[model samples]
Target: MEPGVPDDSENLSDSDIRLETVIQQARLAAGIDGQNYRRRFGSTLETDFGSALLRCEEEGLLEAIPGGAGWRPTSRGFRLNNRIGLLLLEHRSSGPDMDRSNAHGMAES
Candidate 1:
């Protein structure tokens, strides 16, 4: 519910369905390429990304679309993502300023 975070919009429309398809393709490619990369470079990751996603699904954080296009985040997943966003925002705000640029003449004033 934060300014930039999307809420529990789980009901998938036509556009959402298309997005799901794209997500599925991207995940598939990442899984394949990621496994190959691990084997070639000896990644320390024990479980694969795909398996992690499957575990998430099993935990009710996501559910596969009816036509198998891809998965959509459940309400719990939405809450988790929102909380993560909030944490990231808080962390950034609490950290030392990374941008060295002092624009708008405020640093001089």
Candidate 2:
């Protein structure tokens, strides 16, 4: 209902949305390589980058590029990305700058 946030009227579960959102943010911030995710967020993450990508693809939120190792967010995914990014920034700004613990928290279920 808020401006700039994705509509949650779709069938996606809250957990699915959250993981896809985190994946999109990670893709934008640290590149799509799974290694980048593990390095930045640690290897014990509940949802790995590859799994998140697969889930997003399954949910029709991301489309794989033809003959390439990359993917492009679908329109839905794009809106979700923008919405999620804004929410994250807003939350971060509302409090102390996010620390590693908070970053790790995002990866948790």
Candidate 3:
């Protein structure tokens, strides 16, 4: 119902959720803007920033600030993002591409 928010009828993929998680991490590290996100990740934005922010909020990983103009990471969000980052790092170091074994149920053999 909110402007820029994605429709709930559409299903978000795993990559979408992953990107949203990382967005929260980026927001915590830099700020909630495309430029900072692209700078931190070294890639152009692949997901809609507003939708990702909404997903993070729905997942309890982020909270809108008092003025509703920005967000801050929740304690749980910090832990979740750190864990995901470490997992991604480990996955990348293990191989050129993530497979079923390394990604922990992400792929099929």
Please write out the lDDT profile of model 3 over residues 1-109, one tens digit for every residue: 8899876776776455545655555537433444454455543232323434445556666655442324556777676765434443443344343121212111112
Clashing pairs in 2: none
**Model 2 ranges off by over 4 Å:** 1-48, 82-109
Best by TM-score: 3
Ranking by TM-score: 3, 2, 1
TM-score of each: 0.31, 0.33, 0.36
Candidate structures ordered by lDDT, highest first:
3, 2, 1
- Model 3 misplacement above 4 A: 1-48, 82-109
RMSD (Cα, Å) of model 2: 13.4
Tens digit per residue, CA lDDT, model 1, 18-93: 3243334333322223233334434311221233334455666555544322345667756564432333234334
Whole-model Cα lDDT of every candidate shown, in order: 0.38, 0.46, 0.46
- Encode model 2's per-residue lDDT on 20-99: one tens digit a residue: 54556444533244333355555422243334444556666665544332445677766566543444345434543223
lDDT score at residue 106, model 3, on the 0-100 scale: 15
Error of 3 at 13 (Å): 23
Query: Which is the winner by lDDT between candidate 1 and candidate 2?
Result: 2
